[model samples]
Target: MKRKLLFGERMLLGDGTEPFNAVIPFRLHGIFKEEEIRYALGRLQEKHPWLKALIQYDEQHIPWFQVPEATVSIPIRLVNRENEDDWQEESKQEWHSTFDYQTKPLIRFVWIKGEVVSDMLFVFHHCLCDGGSAMALLYEFLKVLDNPNAEIGLENPILGIEDVVPAHILQSGKKQFKAKTIGRLAALAIKCIPVGRKVIDRQTDYLIHWKFDKKTSEQLISYCKSRGITVNTFLGATVLEAFRKVRGAAAFNKVSCPVDIRRFAPQIKDDHIFAFGLMIVMSLNQKLNFMDNLRLMQTEVERKTAKLNPYITMMVMESAHDALKNFTRLLKRGKSSNDCMFSNLGRIQIPDQYRTFSLETVFSPSVIGPLGNTTTMVTSTFRGQMDFSFMGSEGYLPQAEALAIRDEIIGRIRQQLDYKTAS
Candidate 1:
């Protein structure tokens, strides 16, 4: 079975030189037998058809998820762990590693073997799935890894926009005319605009990861609840503040927040392997007080998120597919208008205790695309602790500045909680 790549997915595929990969690294507190690991992956591939497929380009040079008659298991690479941070180093390497999508599956694994603790990195081409889909796969992988006989049901993926947008909407001549007009206007504008010159020279990318203690994590959650704001909104406000403070007032206050499309489109199942993303740009009003700014930001987040129309956005993107190459060029050359991309995976629902192995910690997933501006901060709470993984290139955000921003964000959150406790 094969399906043409979605407009969003094709954008990630780029010129095929740079890989857009997402890696989820988690620590396990038990030894994993090599054969058993392979068996578990084989079972997972059997369940999800996309996991066993490779990317193939048709004569028209369009990419497709092509499933061959011969079964191909997701490959696993083993690295002898020297210390606790071996996985971190391996993750950096994986970020730079390009996938041979023609011959191998879009997903692969890396196992860092330690004496008592092992860290496994689940790496996938970002075009194949988003962080949400990756998390679902991780959950099932653990379940099957712990028990080979475990039954993790099959997934019915959204093959195309037809599956997501209702037939009535697609058939409406008014909607079709609107989409066509918008697409044509966009293409004309793109053609008329000059390609931006690449000014920033990106250096070797780095990832900084840390986890807040359970107490601090709980306090942060309580603080957000007390403010009547979602954790994501609160964190988004803090991130904006941190950049403004550390990178100076001139830094862009815009923070791109990705909303899972599954929330708006029920047809895309939770376990489906898909990569269409909906993003909302959140900005803070510098005139307001810190707390006041947070409240305003929270309100804006709620309002904008509620208004997001996944169907229209998907349709618009599909219409602009003809100008995708130009869009890619613009992205690669243009200066980043946003400070950073912030993603909060919320509290991870994966169990800590499995039958065979116990999950020690789940580091926030990180992905560095070849697109301009590699600064991204990803957060997720697992086992009652909030874990963060910050990725950036020196050219876009220096390592020292990134670390400072991380500390500033954490400090801002803690300071608010501390003040509340004292008052």
Candidate 2:
């Protein structure tokens, strides 16, 4: 049967960091048959267009890929020369880290290359797939290998959402209200806009990650239930609190949250889930104060959650080309991209069904930066625990400073969770 791609599929972000490459680490119990894995990817790529696309530039200074159906060998490079015991673990950073935008990553089959081969890491940029797409690919890959004739195909790529809906029209990517709604919201943005500030003093370097265990997770879950707030609402609160601690109130007026378009268009699948998702902006300043933060954030989050039947984000830029024009191109040359995007891809599924390996923790670090600052975060859940890893540039955010601020903020959440029993 003929397949297709959706609006999000064709839209990928590449001004700096490619937003679709996803990295996954898989453990092999037995020796990996190189040819079998190669064949598996070949068959998978034939069904997914993203793997075939390459990051290249045209004469116009604009970036676009000549997406074609091609199967490149998923090479596993083994470097035999190394002396690690002599230096600090920081010296071994290269093996564990990668520079943003460098999409083509080297896959290392640990067991084959050294004393251990069980932990194999596969890294890719988000230009290839979002969490949904990555999960789809994994499930399909495993299914295809298990059943060669399994019906595995993606919908043909089709454009659905505009890259950038004019802020003047939508005023934050939401379906702007009519004269009546506008009259109401205008009062709201005006009254609420004062406390909000544009983030200034961008830092350039940082290494920060936020992790939540099941106990904390359950506390948050219960807290949300008591307050009629979803975990997403709690996340919105956590994010605003984090930013307020660092960027201050400025994080409020300019926050962008992602809403999936698939709910609005079910016909689209993996290739189509690009940046076509919906966006809803909220006043982050309204989310200050622990109690008020929960109450206000819950309402705001609910407004967006009500639309999940539909999709924001640093991830927003993927489809931002929708608003791309000669005028915008000129204006954005020296401006920030979509303020600060807060993407909470809530709980994820890296199941333990495979006998070969058990699912451990899932770490998602968003590749976000523009206008000298990077403010993006992704959260994942594993074994009843959740961890959030944030990615940003050293140019706008010094790693140490970001972590310092992150720890202070994380401490607040811990305190809140600790008080849950008392409250």
Candidate 3:
């Protein structure tokens, strides 16, 4: 059970020493034993083969995911719970913690142990999976933690590019030619693009987390619904507007949003440990009113999403393997172009209660890589409340400025809801 890492995976792996980690933190409101957690993690690894796999490099230095002859236990770190906010600090610690990729699996569990309430954090190397995959694993973990004998089925792992791109698309000579041409052009552009000789400092990373109560969350959702715009687009507009107002002329007026690849490629299941994503860059029209601007942005989002071709995109990326390093350099040193990357996971579907422990809540996931810009906003609704995790570094965005942007977002949403109430 071994396969070479895909292009996107290699980019994220980044020499295998630097950490590109994602953390999913959730609270459980019942007593849980360490053995129970170990049992549950074992079951999770059984369901997803990649969860137990380790990275190995061949003579040529290309990395591959290989299941060891003997099964490896998923690493678990236990911490005494001091307060409710301990998980956030622990998450920051995990962000900078690099995985021993060659020897161990690219995932770990941190248990903030308490008598009645325990906070569990699942941290993963971004190269192994995306946020959607993490959420699916979280659902399964809770299910199995309650009942170790839970009959969760096994995963049929995606081995190579052939598994994702259909036979017809892979064999199409014309499409192949098109993809190769685009790949060459892109590589050329990256080579020509002027980037700084050194990477940005991005000093002292930080995370800001907050949640709206059920009533306020519902009202915000209702406002977006009444305006006939998606919560994602509305949020994107809100983020861009906030950055513009706070940064003034310093704002880039652009936001990059990651569209889940599973949405377009049926071959990639919700539980597949895959990390490839398609992104669309959006900005607001400065001249239009807020509602009108949201409508336009929504239209643009629809258009871009409709035009996305995962098959071709994957094919093109695969053809550009030789340019991976250069592409990575551009990402690390290129002048910042976007205000931030914003992602809305929408509503979480996992049940909040089990037979034993009642799930307290799920925090919006946070990710920070060594990439040039670390500013990002992630929002998700869990249990009738919308949660947000805003991450940034002092060098890329001052903590004070980030706080101002956060307030602006909350204020803008409230102002819109208030206007609706008055009308």
- Candidate 3 structure, TM-score to reference: 0.99
Better of 1 and 3 by lDDT: 3
- List residue ranges in candidate 2 displaced over 4 A: 1-33, 54-70, 74-127, 142-206, 247-254, 270-273, 285-288, 304-339, 369-372
TM-score of each: 0.98, 0.66, 0.99
Question: Could you give candidate 2's per-residue lDDT for residues 28-69 as a string of tens digits?
Answer: 333345564566666666765545555555565554444533
- Residue 387 of model 3, lDDT score: 99
Best of the candidates, lDDT: 3
Model 2 whole-model lDDT (C-alpha atoms): 0.49
Q: State the weakest 10-residue window (summed lDDT) of model 3.
A: 145-154
Candidates' lDDT values, in order? 0.89, 0.49, 0.94
Query: What lDDT tens digits, residue by residue, belong to model 1 across residues 1-423?
Result: 889898889999876789889999999999779999899888888888889888898899989998889987888899988998998899999988999999999999999998889999999999999998998988998999999899998777567789999888878889888888888898788777776666457887999998899999999999888889888988888899899999995599999999999999988888988899999988989799888887888888889999998887778888888899887887777768899999999988999998778999999999999877889999999989999999999988999999999899878888898899999
Please give, for residues 347-402, the per-residue lDDT of candidate 3 as tens digits: 99999989999998999999999978999999999999999999999999999999
Off by over 4 Å in 1: none
Task: Point out the worst 10-residue segment of candidate 1 by lDDT.
Answer: 191-200
Best-matching candidate per TM-score: 3
